[model samples]
Target: MTPNAREMSESIHEQMPRLLTELAAVVGTTNVLTKPSQQQSYVQGALEAVTDATVAVVIPHSLVALWRVINICAAFDVIIIAQAANTGLTGAQLRMEIMTGR
Candidate 1:
């Protein structure tokens, strides 16, 4: 990985648990996914060739929840990939690979 990417990955790794906890509080524990299995759909797009790289998948049911999650991620400087329908062909959604949600 590039140096910047590596640094971001390390930072996310260090803050993952806390971030997940805060996200869960905002949208509930059921909406926050930390497992690879649960995060599969969020990371994988329309193309099978695109690798799954997200560390967490957060599902916020409302705009309020979405805003809260964004604020929490921003506070930690974690990159977030906003996804919907998984229709995009480009892998820009998973570029940073830290978090994805809808």
Candidate 2:
């Protein structure tokens, strides 16, 4: 591989473990997963019920873990998409999304 590719790989390798460790610390070992097989049930959407999410899922087992996850996104300024149960009429989750940027 090229130097740039190697550097990128190394960076990802370093950051991924750090983030996973942090997540596992906040949450528990059962909630922190890297295996697709174990997480297969959770990957589905409520609406579709079987629509497999293409992204990683972090299920916070406690309030502290949830807060840490939120803080991490805010601190990093990541553009996040928050979804709620579709049972609501409309616009319920939108308010939370708006306040998240602040």
Candidate 3:
């Protein structure tokens, strides 16, 4: 992708907050995270993969917010990664490692 396309991609990503806010009508202005730093980290790889999951992460305090986030991602055809647990090195007793869900 060229720089112009990259700029357009970023602009599209920037609209997620408005979309999420529309879905989660109960959320206040302060609850939404418009910046990347406000989000949490999501890296627990075992092979020392410095996976820069450097994206905004919104933590829902209630079921409403969670539902809203899910709805927004689904409507936008976005990918959601859900992690259950990490066994450090042992791969036993692990039913599901990570859910690369929709």
Task: Name the candidate that leads on TM-score.
Answer: 1
Worst 10 residues of 3 by lDDT: 93-102
lDDT of each: 0.77, 0.53, 0.51
Worst 10 residues of 1 by lDDT: 93-102
| Best-to-worst ranking by TM-score | 1, 2, 3
Candidate 3 structure lDDT = 0.51
Winner by TM-score between candidate 3 and candidate 2? 2
- What would the per-residue lDDT of candidate 2 be over residues 49-68, giving only the tens digit for each residue? 34432224567866777889
By the TM-score metric, which is better: model 1 or model 3? 1
Winning model by lDDT:
1
What TM-score fits each model? Answer: 0.76, 0.50, 0.45
Our model 1 lands, by Cα RMSD against the true structure, at 5.3
**lDDT tens string, model 3, 1-102?**
444545645765887666656644546555655454553333434644443433444456678777877777677655555444443532222223254211
